[model samples]
Target: MEGIVGYGAYIPRNRIKVEEIAKVWGADAPSYKRGLMLEEKSVPSPDQDTITMSVEAAKNALKRCLINPKDIGAVYIGSESHPYAVKPSGTVLAEALGATPEVHTADFEFACKAGTEGMYVALNLVKTGDIKYGLAVGADTSQGAPGDALEYSAAAGAAAFIFGRENIIANALESYSYMTDTPDFWRREYQYYPQHGGRFTGDPAYFKHVMGAAKGIMDKAGMKPSDFNYVTFHQPNGKFPFRVGKMLGFEKKQIEAGWLVNKLGNTYSGSSPLGLTAILDVSKPGDMILIVSYGSGAGSDAFIFEVTKRIEKVRDLAPKTRDLLDNNRRYLEYGEYAKFRQKIKKAS
Candidate 1:
């Protein structure tokens, strides 16, 4: 059967507390905690970018699978913040991963959901026998306006999944999607930060698309929210995903199982995939997992998966999101954060 054979994740080694950001801007606590629900956010170093993070994630995934790079037939990289505008990040990743010249590689972008979108595409390719193994990666180092609310929450991470027909750990059962031409949030070509419609984004864009897709998949599979052992959503912040969970009748236990945003902030394209890696780390053999990913322009992709017995053997090879957060970190002040994010350059 065609399914996910392995998974991996990468979180940077730096963190900035939301309270620190609030102090820097002289903003009240309510805005940072209540509005964003983020206490700390991960910050990548100057040496790391989307491509580097993706490579690390992909490496971990390959290690777990023990598959030769030559066996990977295609590589797909999903990111809105790719290091280079003209070159294909996937191709660069393929080279870094030591995948042979025969592989097909490309990059994808669809706001934040691009990585999930790449997962869907990779699954289809593997199912059709177009590839024996495929890699799908989601990574980003998102930017927000200096001193803006988004600055405190925007972060970086990467997750990679290797899909194949052998040793399947989670089989894809059903999938559903919802799309709309809503401009809930967006950054123009020349813009550094995104423009959002605020309340409109919450009500019609995120809620509508995520709910529509989740419900659609559940309905198609003849299952209810309680049937799944875990549910992970694309976390733009800590609040939005939890709100959607409540609306969809998912319990706190289910939502908390993937509480990535609380500790790591929003990794943009990497958010949902990183959550999936966490789920796989603690999930049992027979557990059912439901995942939803959302992007601006607004769209959502929902997927249903069932864990296999093989998971117990491979689980240890994958990095737990908690460990990734707790063990690896370098604290940064507001000034350092600005320099890492390139808001300021030193005098020549």
Candidate 2:
């Protein structure tokens, strides 16, 4: 069966707290904190972007599986914040990983769900025998207007998963997707920041698609919430994943391992994938997991996986998600954050 052979994630070490941001915008940090359930967000350095983060994450994945980069037949990167408007991020990434020249590569975008989109396609290609192994990555250096609600959660990170039929750590059980033309969020061709429908991003968008995909996948697999040992949903904030889990009949204990938006902010495309990496780090053999990701155009991709004995052998080969998240953090003040994010334009 085609499934995850290796997985890794990269989170920026720089962070800016909600209170720090709130202080600049004259917004109430307590209210913002309570309303969104966010504490801080990771910020990319001037040298970091979608491509750079993807390469780092992919290298980590390689370390886990010890797979030859040249043997990888395909590579895909999903992100909205691709560094160039006309160039493919995959070429740079493939070359960096030494998977170039002979490998097929492409970039993908579907908002926050782009990461899963890449994963889905890569897994299917491997399943079809079109390729021996496929690499899919979801990464974003998300953008938010200086004082918009998104400024609190738009963050940076990347997650990469290598799909192959051998030595699998997580066996794919089933996969599903739900989509629609809902206009909950958009960023025009020349726009620097994205616009969202405020409260509208909820009912008709995130929750609806996420719930639909989750339930549809469970029904297709003939399983229920109780059948899975762990579940992770796209976390736009600290509250959404928990709220959605409750609505779907999952307990907090099952969802907590992957609910990192509170401290990490929303990594958009990396959100759910990174959560899955976190869950896999602690999962035992035979454990089942469900991951559902939402992108705000809007739609969701859902997958079910059963852990294998190989997971324990490779989990320590690379940095764990929590270790990258919690250790040696460099906090940034609002002004420094602004400079790094380019919120304040420098004279060119």
Q: Residue 72 deviation, candidate 1, in Å?
A: 0.8
**What's the TM for model 2?**
0.99
TM-score list, all predictions:
0.97, 0.99
Give the Å error, residue 249, model 1. 1.3
In candidate 2, residue 347 scores what lDDT? 86
- The C-alpha lDDT values of all candidates are 0.89, 0.95
Best by lDDT: 2
- Model 2, 54-74: lDDT tens per residue? 999999999999999998999
lDDT of 1 by residue, 1-348 (tens): 788998999999899988878888899867678778888899999999999999999998987888889999989999899888798999889999989599989898989998998898888899899899989999999887877777888899999999999999999888778999999888888677788787787888988999999999999999999899999998988988888999999988997877799889989899988899998888999899999999889899888889999999887876766799889578999988888999885798
**Clash pairs for candidate 1:** none
Question: Whose TM-score is greatest here?
Answer: 2
lDDT, residue 159, candidate 1 = 95
State the displacement of the C-alpha of residue 145, model 2, in Å, after optimal TM-score superposition.
Answer: 0.5
